[model samples]
Target: MNPREHIPVLLEESLALLDIGRDGIYIDGTLGLAGHAEEILKRNPRARLVGIDLDDRSIRKAQARLQPFEDRVDLYHADFKCIPELDIDFPAVRGILLDLGMSSYQLDTADRGFGHSQEGPLDMRMDDRNKLTAAKILDKYPEPKLAQLFREYGELKQAAKLARKIASVRRTQKIESTTHLRGLVEEVCHWIPQRGKIHPAAKVFQALRIEVNQELQGLGEFLIEAIGLVGPGTRLAVISFHSLEDRIVKHTLARLSRPEYGDSVIDILTKHPVVPSEDEVARNPRSRSAKLRAAVKRPHGS
Candidate 1:
Protein backbone atom coordinates (compact mmCIF):
# COMPACT_ATOMS: atom_id res chain seq x y z
CA MET A 1 0.00 0.00 0.00
CA ASN A 2 2.93 2.33 0.67
CA PRO A 3 6.69 2.51 0.18
CA ARG A 4 7.34 1.51 3.76
CA GLU A 5 5.37 -1.68 3.21
CA HIS A 6 7.34 -2.74 0.11
CA ILE A 7 9.51 -5.73 1.01
CA PRO A 8 12.56 -6.23 -1.19
CA VAL A 9 12.53 -9.89 -2.21
CA LEU A 10 15.71 -11.87 -1.41
CA LEU A 11 17.04 -8.96 0.61
CA GLU A 12 19.62 -10.69 2.85
CA GLU A 13 20.63 -13.18 0.18
CA SER A 14 21.44 -10.42 -2.30
CA LEU A 15 23.25 -8.24 0.25
CA ALA A 16 25.46 -11.13 1.32
CA LEU A 17 26.57 -11.81 -2.25
CA LEU A 18 27.17 -8.10 -2.78
CA ASP A 19 29.71 -8.09 0.11
CA ILE A 20 28.84 -4.43 0.63
CA GLY A 21 31.38 -3.36 3.23
CA ARG A 22 33.82 -1.76 0.75
CA ASP A 23 33.91 1.97 0.06
CA GLY A 24 32.34 2.28 -3.39
CA ILE A 25 29.05 2.72 -5.20
CA TYR A 26 26.28 0.12 -5.29
CA ILE A 27 23.82 0.44 -8.14
CA ASP A 28 20.18 -0.55 -7.65
CA GLY A 29 19.13 -0.87 -11.27
CA THR A 30 15.48 -1.61 -10.55
CA LEU A 31 15.16 0.63 -7.50
CA GLY A 32 11.38 0.25 -7.09
CA LEU A 33 10.66 2.15 -3.87
CA ALA A 34 14.29 2.03 -2.68
CA GLY A 35 13.57 -0.93 -0.41
CA HIS A 36 16.95 -2.56 -0.95
CA ALA A 37 18.74 0.71 -1.57
CA GLU A 38 17.71 2.00 1.83
CA GLU A 39 19.05 -1.12 3.49
CA ILE A 40 22.33 -0.97 1.59
CA LEU A 41 22.88 2.59 2.72
CA LYS A 42 21.75 1.88 6.23
CA ARG A 43 23.88 -1.20 6.71
CA ASN A 44 26.99 -0.28 4.75
CA PRO A 45 28.40 2.96 6.08
CA ARG A 46 31.05 3.13 3.36
CA ALA A 47 28.63 2.48 0.51
CA ARG A 48 27.16 5.09 -1.80
CA LEU A 49 24.34 4.12 -4.17
CA VAL A 50 23.13 4.85 -7.67
CA GLY A 51 19.42 4.06 -7.88
CA ILE A 52 17.57 3.82 -11.19
CA ASP A 53 13.95 3.05 -12.08
CA LEU A 54 11.55 3.55 -14.99
CA ASP A 55 8.60 4.57 -12.81
CA ASP A 56 8.66 8.26 -11.90
CA ARG A 57 6.23 7.69 -9.05
CA SER A 58 8.52 5.06 -7.54
CA ILE A 59 11.57 7.28 -8.10
CA ARG A 60 9.93 10.18 -6.25
CA LYS A 61 9.05 7.87 -3.39
CA ALA A 62 12.55 6.38 -3.45
CA GLN A 63 14.01 9.86 -3.39
CA ALA A 64 11.92 10.74 -0.35
CA ARG A 65 12.69 7.42 1.35
CA LEU A 66 16.40 7.94 0.70
CA GLN A 67 16.50 11.59 1.77
CA PRO A 68 18.77 10.85 4.73
CA PHE A 69 21.37 9.41 2.38
CA GLU A 70 20.99 11.94 -0.44
CA ASP A 71 24.66 12.89 -0.28
CA ARG A 72 25.58 9.24 -0.93
CA VAL A 73 22.95 8.53 -3.57
CA ASP A 74 22.26 9.44 -7.19
CA LEU A 75 18.67 8.94 -8.32
CA TYR A 76 17.96 8.43 -12.03
CA HIS A 77 14.68 8.54 -13.96
CA ALA A 78 15.47 5.92 -16.64
CA ASP A 79 15.42 2.27 -17.59
CA PHE A 80 17.97 -0.18 -16.16
CA LYS A 81 18.85 -1.02 -19.78
CA CYS A 82 20.28 2.50 -19.90
CA ILE A 83 22.85 1.48 -17.24
CA PRO A 84 25.67 1.27 -19.79
CA GLU A 85 25.13 4.90 -20.84
CA LEU A 86 24.87 6.34 -17.36
CA ASP A 87 27.71 8.49 -15.98
CA ILE A 88 28.99 5.98 -13.45
CA ASP A 89 32.43 5.45 -11.97
CA PHE A 90 32.81 1.90 -13.22
CA PRO A 91 36.04 1.19 -11.41
CA ALA A 92 34.68 2.26 -8.04
CA VAL A 93 31.46 0.24 -8.39
CA ARG A 94 31.19 -2.40 -5.67
CA GLY A 95 28.00 -4.12 -6.72
CA ILE A 96 24.94 -3.89 -8.96
CA LEU A 97 21.43 -5.20 -8.26
CA LEU A 98 18.49 -5.63 -10.60
CA ASP A 99 15.20 -6.83 -9.18
CA LEU A 100 13.31 -7.50 -12.39
CA GLY A 101 9.95 -7.93 -10.67
CA MET A 102 7.44 -5.11 -10.98
CA SER A 103 7.32 -3.05 -7.78
CA SER A 104 4.40 -3.67 -5.41
CA TYR A 105 3.61 0.05 -5.64
CA GLN A 106 3.09 -0.25 -9.38
CA LEU A 107 0.95 -3.35 -9.01
CA ASP A 108 -1.09 -1.75 -6.23
CA THR A 109 -1.79 1.36 -8.29
CA ALA A 110 -4.90 0.64 -10.37
CA ASP A 111 -4.12 3.01 -13.25
CA ARG A 112 -0.77 1.28 -13.93
CA GLY A 113 -2.68 -1.86 -15.00
CA PHE A 114 0.02 -4.20 -13.69
CA GLY A 115 -2.47 -6.17 -11.61
CA HIS A 116 -5.49 -8.10 -12.89
CA SER A 117 -6.96 -8.17 -9.36
CA GLN A 118 -7.41 -4.41 -9.63
CA GLU A 119 -9.94 -2.78 -11.97
CA GLY A 120 -8.23 -0.22 -14.21
CA PRO A 121 -7.48 0.74 -17.80
CA LEU A 122 -5.01 -1.21 -19.94
CA ASP A 123 -2.10 1.22 -19.62
CA MET A 124 0.64 -1.17 -18.32
CA ARG A 125 3.45 1.21 -19.19
CA MET A 126 6.16 1.41 -16.49
CA ASP A 127 7.55 4.48 -18.20
CA ASP A 128 4.86 6.99 -19.17
CA ARG A 129 6.99 8.21 -22.13
CA ASN A 130 6.61 4.81 -23.82
CA LYS A 131 4.09 4.96 -26.68
CA LEU A 132 3.02 1.33 -26.51
CA THR A 133 0.30 0.19 -24.10
CA ALA A 134 -1.58 -3.01 -23.25
CA ALA A 135 -4.77 -1.61 -24.79
CA LYS A 136 -2.92 -0.66 -28.00
CA ILE A 137 -1.53 -4.18 -28.31
CA LEU A 138 -4.97 -5.72 -27.75
CA ASP A 139 -6.57 -3.33 -30.19
CA LYS A 140 -3.95 -3.59 -32.93
CA TYR A 141 -2.42 -7.07 -32.82
CA PRO A 142 -3.89 -9.71 -35.10
CA GLU A 143 -5.34 -12.87 -33.64
CA PRO A 144 -2.32 -14.98 -34.61
CA LYS A 145 0.15 -12.51 -33.07
CA LEU A 146 -1.90 -12.31 -29.92
CA ALA A 147 -1.92 -16.10 -29.77
CA GLN A 148 1.85 -16.16 -30.13
CA LEU A 149 2.22 -13.57 -27.35
CA PHE A 150 -0.02 -15.43 -24.94
CA ARG A 151 1.71 -18.70 -25.71
CA GLU A 152 5.29 -17.42 -25.47
CA TYR A 153 5.04 -14.88 -22.68
CA GLY A 154 2.22 -16.22 -20.54
CA GLU A 155 2.69 -19.87 -21.46
CA LEU A 156 -1.09 -20.04 -21.58
CA LYS A 157 -2.40 -23.41 -22.80
CA GLN A 158 -5.49 -21.80 -24.28
CA ALA A 159 -3.58 -19.15 -26.26
CA ALA A 160 -5.30 -19.64 -29.60
CA LYS A 161 -8.68 -20.03 -27.97
CA LEU A 162 -8.23 -16.81 -25.99
CA ALA A 163 -6.90 -14.90 -29.00
CA ARG A 164 -9.91 -15.98 -31.00
CA LYS A 165 -12.12 -14.89 -28.12
CA ILE A 166 -10.50 -11.44 -28.06
CA ALA A 167 -10.85 -11.18 -31.84
CA SER A 168 -14.57 -11.81 -31.49
CA VAL A 169 -15.07 -9.35 -28.63
CA ARG A 170 -13.06 -6.40 -30.05
CA ARG A 171 -15.16 -6.31 -33.18
CA THR A 172 -18.13 -4.93 -31.25
CA GLN A 173 -16.45 -3.42 -28.20
CA LYS A 174 -12.96 -2.18 -27.27
CA ILE A 175 -10.80 -4.04 -24.72
CA GLU A 176 -10.12 -0.86 -22.74
CA SER A 177 -10.21 -1.85 -19.08
CA THR A 178 -8.17 -4.39 -17.12
CA THR A 179 -11.40 -5.88 -15.75
CA HIS A 180 -12.86 -6.11 -19.25
CA LEU A 181 -9.91 -8.10 -20.57
CA ARG A 182 -9.64 -10.08 -17.33
CA GLY A 183 -13.27 -11.17 -17.58
CA LEU A 184 -12.73 -12.27 -21.18
CA VAL A 185 -9.62 -14.29 -20.21
CA GLU A 186 -11.53 -15.94 -17.36
CA GLU A 187 -14.38 -16.77 -19.68
CA VAL A 188 -12.07 -18.28 -22.29
CA CYS A 189 -10.07 -20.25 -19.73
CA HIS A 190 -13.27 -21.33 -17.91
CA TRP A 191 -13.54 -19.45 -14.66
CA ILE A 192 -12.92 -21.50 -11.54
CA PRO A 193 -11.40 -20.33 -8.29
CA GLN A 194 -9.34 -22.89 -6.47
CA ARG A 195 -6.97 -22.46 -3.53
CA GLY A 196 -3.30 -22.04 -4.53
CA LYS A 197 -4.10 -21.98 -8.24
CA ILE A 198 -2.94 -18.96 -10.22
CA HIS A 199 -5.68 -17.16 -12.15
CA PRO A 200 -5.55 -17.19 -15.95
CA ALA A 201 -6.11 -13.45 -15.94
CA ALA A 202 -2.87 -13.02 -13.98
CA LYS A 203 -1.00 -14.75 -16.76
CA VAL A 204 -2.78 -12.63 -19.38
CA PHE A 205 -1.95 -9.42 -17.55
CA GLN A 206 1.71 -10.50 -17.15
CA ALA A 207 1.97 -11.24 -20.87
CA LEU A 208 0.46 -7.84 -21.71
CA ARG A 209 2.72 -6.06 -19.21
CA ILE A 210 5.84 -7.73 -20.65
CA GLU A 211 4.86 -6.75 -24.18
CA VAL A 212 3.94 -3.17 -23.24
CA ASN A 213 7.24 -2.57 -21.41
CA GLN A 214 9.57 -4.72 -23.61
CA GLU A 215 10.70 -6.25 -20.30
CA LEU A 216 12.68 -9.11 -21.84
CA GLN A 217 14.08 -7.51 -25.00
CA GLY A 218 17.25 -5.90 -23.70
CA LEU A 219 17.78 -7.75 -20.40
CA GLY A 220 20.46 -10.26 -21.42
CA GLU A 221 22.33 -7.73 -23.54
CA PHE A 222 22.36 -5.29 -20.64
CA LEU A 223 23.78 -7.91 -18.25
CA ILE A 224 26.56 -8.85 -20.65
CA GLU A 225 27.46 -5.23 -21.34
CA ALA A 226 27.31 -4.33 -17.65
CA ILE A 227 29.60 -7.19 -16.68
CA GLY A 228 31.98 -6.12 -19.41
CA LEU A 229 31.95 -2.54 -18.13
CA VAL A 230 32.70 -3.12 -14.46
CA GLY A 231 36.06 -3.98 -12.92
CA PRO A 232 37.19 -7.37 -11.71
CA GLY A 233 35.60 -8.45 -8.38
CA THR A 234 32.57 -6.22 -8.96
CA ARG A 235 29.50 -8.20 -7.99
CA LEU A 236 26.13 -8.35 -9.77
CA ALA A 237 22.89 -9.67 -8.33
CA VAL A 238 19.63 -10.13 -10.23
CA ILE A 239 16.20 -11.12 -8.90
CA SER A 240 13.94 -12.19 -11.74
CA PHE A 241 10.26 -13.10 -11.18
CA HIS A 242 9.26 -15.25 -14.15
CA SER A 243 10.92 -18.18 -15.87
CA LEU A 244 11.30 -16.16 -19.09
CA GLU A 245 13.51 -13.61 -17.32
CA ASP A 246 15.23 -16.13 -15.00
CA ARG A 247 16.24 -18.08 -18.11
CA ILE A 248 17.92 -15.02 -19.60
CA VAL A 249 19.80 -14.24 -16.37
CA LYS A 250 20.82 -17.87 -15.94
CA HIS A 251 22.11 -18.25 -19.50
CA THR A 252 23.88 -14.91 -19.52
CA LEU A 253 25.69 -15.68 -16.27
CA ALA A 254 26.53 -19.17 -17.51
CA ARG A 255 27.99 -17.83 -20.73
CA LEU A 256 30.03 -15.24 -18.92
CA SER A 257 31.33 -17.77 -16.42
CA ARG A 258 32.66 -19.98 -19.23
CA PRO A 259 36.32 -19.58 -20.13
CA GLU A 260 36.88 -17.65 -23.35
CA TYR A 261 40.28 -16.36 -24.53
CA GLY A 262 41.80 -18.56 -21.80
CA ASP A 263 39.90 -16.70 -19.07
CA SER A 264 36.38 -16.67 -17.71
CA VAL A 265 34.94 -13.19 -17.23
CA ILE A 266 32.85 -13.94 -14.18
CA ASP A 267 32.40 -16.60 -11.53
CA ILE A 268 28.78 -17.55 -10.96
CA LEU A 269 28.22 -17.22 -7.23
CA THR A 270 25.12 -19.41 -7.14
CA LYS A 271 25.43 -22.61 -9.16
CA HIS A 272 21.63 -22.43 -9.09
CA PRO A 273 19.40 -19.49 -8.27
CA VAL A 274 18.87 -18.58 -4.61
CA VAL A 275 15.15 -18.53 -4.01
CA PRO A 276 13.23 -17.00 -1.11
CA SER A 277 12.49 -19.22 1.88
CA GLU A 278 8.96 -20.33 2.70
CA ASP A 279 8.86 -17.88 5.61
CA GLU A 280 9.58 -14.88 3.38
CA VAL A 281 7.07 -16.06 0.79
CA ALA A 282 4.43 -16.48 3.49
CA ARG A 283 5.06 -12.91 4.62
CA ASN A 284 5.16 -11.42 1.11
CA PRO A 285 3.17 -13.49 -1.31
CA ARG A 286 4.28 -11.42 -4.32
CA SER A 287 7.86 -12.62 -3.68
CA ARG A 288 7.05 -16.32 -3.87
CA SER A 289 8.17 -16.57 -7.50
CA ALA A 290 11.44 -14.61 -7.18
CA LYS A 291 14.79 -16.21 -8.08
CA LEU A 292 18.07 -14.51 -7.27
CA ARG A 293 21.32 -15.19 -9.11
CA ALA A 294 24.62 -13.49 -8.44
CA ALA A 295 28.11 -13.33 -9.99
CA VAL A 296 31.40 -11.54 -9.55
CA LYS A 297 33.74 -10.43 -12.33
CA ARG A 298 36.93 -12.48 -12.28
CA PRO A 299 40.42 -11.06 -12.40
CA HIS A 300 42.29 -11.47 -15.68
CA GLY A 301 44.32 -14.61 -16.49
CA SER A 302 43.29 -16.30 -13.26
Candidate 2:
Protein backbone atom coordinates (compact mmCIF):
# COMPACT_ATOMS: atom_id res chain seq x y z
CA MET A 1 0.00 0.00 0.00
CA ASN A 2 1.12 3.56 -0.72
CA PRO A 3 1.96 5.68 2.33
CA ARG A 4 0.90 9.07 1.01
CA GLU A 5 -2.63 7.84 0.45
CA HIS A 6 -2.97 6.89 4.10
CA ILE A 7 -4.81 9.56 6.07
CA PRO A 8 -4.07 9.28 9.77
CA VAL A 9 -7.04 10.11 11.93
CA LEU A 10 -6.88 13.21 14.14
CA LEU A 11 -3.51 14.35 12.79
CA GLU A 12 -3.95 18.07 13.54
CA GLU A 13 -5.26 17.48 17.04
CA SER A 14 -2.40 15.11 17.82
CA LEU A 15 0.31 17.53 16.69
CA ALA A 16 -1.27 20.43 18.58
CA LEU A 17 -1.39 18.46 21.83
CA LEU A 18 2.12 16.99 21.37
CA ASP A 19 3.76 20.42 21.04
CA ILE A 20 6.70 19.20 19.01
CA GLY A 21 10.10 20.73 19.78
CA ARG A 22 12.60 21.95 17.21
CA ASP A 23 15.64 20.00 18.40
CA GLY A 24 13.94 17.36 20.48
CA ILE A 25 14.05 13.58 20.28
CA TYR A 26 10.65 12.00 19.56
CA ILE A 27 9.22 8.53 19.22
CA ASP A 28 6.26 7.52 17.08
CA GLY A 29 5.59 4.32 18.97
CA THR A 30 3.00 3.05 16.50
CA LEU A 31 4.25 4.40 13.20
CA GLY A 32 1.51 2.86 11.10
CA LEU A 33 2.01 4.68 7.79
CA ALA A 34 4.45 7.24 9.20
CA GLY A 35 1.84 9.94 8.57
CA HIS A 36 2.35 11.42 12.03
CA ALA A 37 6.13 11.01 11.83
CA GLU A 38 6.21 12.88 8.53
CA GLU A 39 4.40 15.83 10.11
CA ILE A 40 6.64 15.80 13.16
CA LEU A 41 9.79 15.80 11.03
CA LYS A 42 8.51 18.54 8.73
CA ARG A 43 7.74 20.77 11.72
CA ASN A 44 11.33 20.80 13.00
CA PRO A 45 14.59 20.37 11.07
CA ARG A 46 16.65 19.52 14.16
CA ALA A 47 14.13 17.14 15.66
CA ARG A 48 15.05 13.43 15.50
CA LEU A 49 12.41 10.72 15.44
CA VAL A 50 12.41 7.02 16.18
CA GLY A 51 9.53 5.39 14.32
CA ILE A 52 8.52 1.89 15.41
CA ASP A 53 5.94 -0.54 14.13
CA LEU A 54 5.52 -4.30 14.33
CA ASP A 55 3.94 -4.58 10.92
CA ASP A 56 6.51 -5.21 8.23
CA ARG A 57 4.30 -3.73 5.52
CA SER A 58 3.97 -0.52 7.51
CA ILE A 59 7.70 -0.43 8.13
CA ARG A 60 8.38 -0.77 4.41
CA LYS A 61 5.85 1.88 3.50
CA ALA A 62 7.07 4.25 6.24
CA GLN A 63 10.67 3.69 5.31
CA ALA A 64 9.85 4.72 1.77
CA ARG A 65 7.57 7.58 2.80
CA LEU A 66 10.00 9.04 5.32
CA GLN A 67 13.08 8.67 3.09
CA PRO A 68 13.52 12.41 2.65
CA PHE A 69 13.92 12.80 6.42
CA GLU A 70 16.60 10.11 6.70
CA ASP A 71 18.91 12.54 8.42
CA ARG A 72 16.47 12.92 11.29
CA VAL A 73 14.55 9.62 11.40
CA ASP A 74 15.47 6.07 12.38
CA LEU A 75 12.96 3.35 11.53
CA TYR A 76 12.55 0.22 13.66
CA HIS A 77 10.83 -2.98 12.64
CA ALA A 78 9.75 -4.06 16.09
CA ASP A 79 6.86 -3.96 18.50
CA PHE A 80 5.98 -0.68 20.25
CA LYS A 81 5.95 -2.46 23.62
CA CYS A 82 9.72 -2.91 23.34
CA ILE A 83 10.58 0.73 22.53
CA PRO A 84 12.29 1.19 25.91
CA GLU A 85 14.92 -1.39 24.89
CA LEU A 86 15.78 0.20 21.54
CA ASP A 87 19.44 1.30 21.23
CA ILE A 88 18.79 4.91 20.15
CA ASP A 89 20.04 7.12 23.00
CA PHE A 90 18.91 10.73 23.17
CA PRO A 91 19.63 12.68 26.36
CA ALA A 92 15.89 12.99 26.89
CA VAL A 93 13.01 12.26 24.57
CA ARG A 94 10.97 15.40 23.88
CA GLY A 95 7.73 13.51 23.36
CA ILE A 96 6.30 10.10 22.62
CA LEU A 97 3.14 9.37 20.64
CA LEU A 98 1.26 6.09 20.49
CA ASP A 99 -1.56 5.78 17.98
CA LEU A 100 -2.86 2.37 18.86
CA GLY A 101 -5.16 0.68 16.38
CA MET A 102 -4.97 -1.30 13.15
CA SER A 103 -4.37 1.22 10.39
CA SER A 104 -6.99 1.71 7.68
CA TYR A 105 -4.56 0.31 5.13
CA GLN A 106 -4.31 -2.87 7.11
CA LEU A 107 -8.08 -3.23 7.25
CA ASP A 108 -8.55 -2.22 3.65
CA THR A 109 -5.94 -4.64 2.35
CA ALA A 110 -8.29 -7.58 3.10
CA ASP A 111 -5.45 -10.11 3.04
CA ARG A 112 -4.35 -8.93 6.50
CA GLY A 113 -7.50 -10.38 8.03
CA PHE A 114 -8.22 -7.25 10.09
CA GLY A 115 -11.70 -6.66 8.68
CA HIS A 116 -14.55 -9.15 8.59
CA SER A 117 -16.03 -7.61 5.46
CA GLN A 118 -13.18 -9.09 3.44
CA GLU A 119 -12.42 -12.72 2.68
CA GLY A 120 -8.86 -13.63 3.61
CA PRO A 121 -6.77 -15.85 5.83
CA LEU A 122 -7.76 -15.70 9.45
CA ASP A 123 -4.27 -14.55 10.34
CA MET A 124 -4.52 -11.36 12.40
CA ARG A 125 -0.96 -10.93 13.61
CA MET A 126 -0.10 -7.26 13.22
CA ASP A 127 3.53 -8.22 13.12
CA ASP A 128 3.96 -11.25 10.93
CA ARG A 129 6.81 -12.20 13.26
CA ASN A 130 4.28 -13.13 15.92
CA LYS A 131 3.55 -16.88 15.97
CA LEU A 132 -0.07 -16.69 17.08
CA THR A 133 -2.71 -16.18 14.42
CA ALA A 134 -6.50 -16.02 14.77
CA ALA A 135 -6.82 -19.35 13.01
CA LYS A 136 -4.40 -21.01 15.41
CA ILE A 137 -6.28 -19.63 18.40
CA LEU A 138 -9.60 -20.89 17.08
CA ASP A 139 -8.27 -24.34 16.32
CA LYS A 140 -5.94 -24.85 19.29
CA TYR A 141 -7.01 -22.79 22.29
CA PRO A 142 -9.18 -24.57 24.81
CA GLU A 143 -12.84 -23.62 24.89
CA PRO A 144 -12.52 -22.05 28.34
CA LYS A 145 -9.47 -20.08 27.30
CA LEU A 146 -11.18 -18.85 24.13
CA ALA A 147 -14.23 -17.86 26.16
CA GLN A 148 -12.09 -15.87 28.56
CA LEU A 149 -10.30 -14.10 25.71
CA PHE A 150 -13.58 -13.10 24.06
CA ARG A 151 -15.02 -11.92 27.37
CA GLU A 152 -12.03 -9.82 28.36
CA TYR A 153 -11.00 -8.49 24.95
CA GLY A 154 -14.32 -8.04 23.22
CA GLU A 155 -16.49 -7.41 26.30
CA LEU A 156 -19.00 -9.60 24.50
CA LYS A 157 -22.03 -10.61 26.52
CA GLN A 158 -22.24 -14.10 25.03
CA ALA A 159 -18.61 -15.12 25.12
CA ALA A 160 -19.22 -18.61 26.44
CA LYS A 161 -21.84 -19.35 23.86
CA LEU A 162 -19.70 -17.91 21.08
CA ALA A 163 -16.68 -19.89 22.21
CA ARG A 164 -18.70 -23.11 22.29
CA LYS A 165 -19.93 -22.49 18.79
CA ILE A 166 -16.41 -21.83 17.51
CA ALA A 167 -15.11 -24.95 19.19
CA SER A 168 -17.83 -27.12 17.70
CA VAL A 169 -17.44 -25.66 14.22
CA ARG A 170 -13.68 -25.91 14.25
CA ARG A 171 -13.88 -29.59 15.08
CA THR A 172 -15.49 -30.17 11.67
CA GLN A 173 -13.28 -27.81 9.62
CA LYS A 174 -10.47 -25.40 10.22
CA ILE A 175 -11.66 -21.80 10.54
CA GLU A 176 -9.04 -20.69 8.03
CA SER A 177 -10.49 -17.39 6.82
CA THR A 178 -12.33 -14.25 7.86
CA THR A 179 -15.48 -15.19 5.97
CA HIS A 180 -15.51 -18.59 7.67
CA LEU A 181 -15.27 -17.04 11.09
CA ARG A 182 -17.89 -14.42 10.31
CA GLY A 183 -20.29 -17.11 9.26
CA LEU A 184 -19.66 -19.02 12.45
CA VAL A 185 -20.27 -15.91 14.54
CA GLU A 186 -23.60 -15.34 12.83
CA GLU A 187 -24.59 -18.93 13.45
CA VAL A 188 -23.84 -18.66 17.15
CA CYS A 189 -24.97 -15.09 17.89
CA HIS A 190 -28.50 -15.35 16.60
CA TRP A 191 -29.72 -13.14 19.46
CA ILE A 192 -27.72 -10.12 18.20
CA PRO A 193 -30.58 -9.36 15.76
CA GLN A 194 -30.22 -8.59 12.07
CA ARG A 195 -30.43 -4.78 12.27
CA GLY A 196 -27.77 -2.61 13.94
CA LYS A 197 -25.17 0.07 13.25
CA ILE A 198 -22.31 -2.43 13.53
CA HIS A 199 -21.99 -5.84 11.95
CA PRO A 200 -22.65 -8.75 14.27
CA ALA A 201 -19.18 -10.15 13.61
CA ALA A 202 -17.52 -6.93 14.71
CA LYS A 203 -17.02 -7.95 18.34
CA VAL A 204 -15.67 -11.39 17.47
CA PHE A 205 -13.18 -9.99 14.97
CA GLN A 206 -12.13 -7.34 17.49
CA ALA A 207 -11.57 -10.02 20.15
CA LEU A 208 -9.46 -12.12 17.82
CA ARG A 209 -7.38 -9.14 16.76
CA ILE A 210 -6.72 -8.15 20.37
CA GLU A 211 -5.79 -11.70 21.32
CA VAL A 212 -3.58 -12.19 18.26
CA ASN A 213 -1.66 -9.00 18.97
CA GLN A 214 -1.60 -9.29 22.77
CA GLU A 215 -2.69 -5.66 22.65
CA LEU A 216 -3.57 -5.32 26.34
CA GLN A 217 -1.20 -7.83 27.93
CA GLY A 218 1.98 -5.74 27.98
CA LEU A 219 0.41 -2.28 27.53
CA GLY A 220 0.63 -1.20 31.18
CA GLU A 221 4.31 -2.09 31.40
CA PHE A 222 5.03 -0.50 28.02
CA LEU A 223 3.33 2.78 29.02
CA ILE A 224 5.18 2.90 32.36
CA GLU A 225 8.55 2.28 30.75
CA ALA A 226 8.00 4.78 27.92
CA ILE A 227 6.80 7.57 30.25
CA GLY A 228 9.93 7.20 32.37
CA LEU A 229 12.03 8.04 29.30
CA VAL A 230 10.54 11.52 29.02
CA GLY A 231 12.70 14.17 30.71
CA PRO A 232 11.37 17.29 32.34
CA GLY A 233 9.68 19.55 29.72
CA THR A 234 8.84 16.64 27.45
CA ARG A 235 5.28 15.60 26.75
CA LEU A 236 3.65 12.24 26.02
CA ALA A 237 0.51 11.79 23.97
CA VAL A 238 -1.59 8.70 23.34
CA ILE A 239 -4.43 8.31 20.85
CA SER A 240 -6.62 5.37 21.63
CA PHE A 241 -9.51 4.13 19.50
CA HIS A 242 -11.59 2.30 22.07
CA SER A 243 -12.41 2.39 25.76
CA LEU A 244 -10.21 -0.58 26.64
CA GLU A 245 -7.08 1.16 25.31
CA ASP A 246 -8.24 4.61 26.48
CA ARG A 247 -8.64 3.34 30.05
CA ILE A 248 -5.12 1.99 30.04
CA VAL A 249 -3.61 5.26 28.80
CA LYS A 250 -5.75 7.37 31.12
CA HIS A 251 -4.84 5.46 34.28
CA THR A 252 -1.19 5.11 33.37
CA LEU A 253 -0.74 8.83 32.68
CA ALA A 254 -2.68 9.73 35.82
CA ARG A 255 -0.44 7.53 37.94
CA LEU A 256 2.73 9.10 36.52
CA SER A 257 1.51 12.68 36.93
CA ARG A 258 -0.12 12.34 40.35
CA PRO A 259 1.75 14.18 43.14
CA GLU A 260 0.69 12.26 46.25
CA TYR A 261 3.78 10.19 47.07
CA GLY A 262 6.81 12.45 47.61
CA ASP A 263 6.19 14.82 44.69
CA SER A 264 5.44 13.48 41.23
CA VAL A 265 7.63 14.04 38.17
CA ILE A 266 4.92 14.79 35.65
CA ASP A 267 1.82 16.93 35.13
CA ILE A 268 -1.32 16.00 33.25
CA LEU A 269 -1.67 18.39 30.33
CA THR A 270 -5.14 17.44 29.14
CA LYS A 271 -7.52 17.26 32.09
CA HIS A 272 -10.01 16.23 29.46
CA PRO A 273 -8.95 14.20 26.45
CA VAL A 274 -8.61 16.09 23.14
CA VAL A 275 -10.96 14.52 20.67
CA PRO A 276 -11.43 15.33 17.00
CA SER A 277 -13.41 18.49 16.19
CA GLU A 278 -16.75 18.14 14.47
CA ASP A 279 -15.19 19.40 11.26
CA GLU A 280 -12.40 16.83 11.32
CA VAL A 281 -14.87 14.11 12.21
CA ALA A 282 -16.97 15.14 9.26
CA ARG A 283 -13.96 15.14 6.96
CA ASN A 284 -12.72 11.77 8.19
CA PRO A 285 -15.28 9.65 9.96
CA ARG A 286 -12.55 7.45 11.37
CA SER A 287 -11.39 10.39 13.50
CA ARG A 288 -14.67 10.37 15.37
CA SER A 289 -13.63 7.48 17.61
CA ALA A 290 -10.20 8.85 18.45
CA LYS A 291 -9.44 10.28 21.90
CA LEU A 292 -6.05 11.90 22.45
CA ARG A 293 -4.64 12.41 25.94
CA ALA A 294 -1.43 14.22 26.81
CA ALA A 295 0.83 14.89 29.81
CA VAL A 296 4.16 16.60 30.40
CA LYS A 297 7.13 15.71 32.56
CA ARG A 298 7.48 18.08 35.52
CA PRO A 299 10.78 19.76 36.27
CA HIS A 300 12.85 17.97 38.89
CA GLY A 301 11.70 18.71 42.46
CA SER A 302 8.62 20.97 42.15
Error (Å) of candidate 2 at residue 284 is: 1.9
Tens digits of lDDT, candidate 2, 1-302: 45434678778778877888547788999999999999999888888999999999989988888899998888889988888788867455788889998888888888889889889999988989899999999999999999998888887778999899988887788989999888877777773655535665888888899989988888877777766665677777899988898999898888877776333357888899889888887777767789988887787788
Model 2 gets an lDDT of 0.83
Q: In angstroms, give how far residue 90 of model 1 lies from its true place.
A: 0.6
Candidate 1 lDDT score relative to the true structure: 0.91
Task: Output the number of the TM-score-best candidate.
Answer: 1
Cα lDDT, model 1, residue 16: 94
Q: Any runs in candidate 1 off by more than 4 Å, and if so which? A: 1-4, 261-264
Pairs with steric clashes in candidate 2 = none
Each model's total of backbone clashes: 0, 0
User: What is the TM-score of each predicted model, taking all chains together?
Assistant: 0.97, 0.94
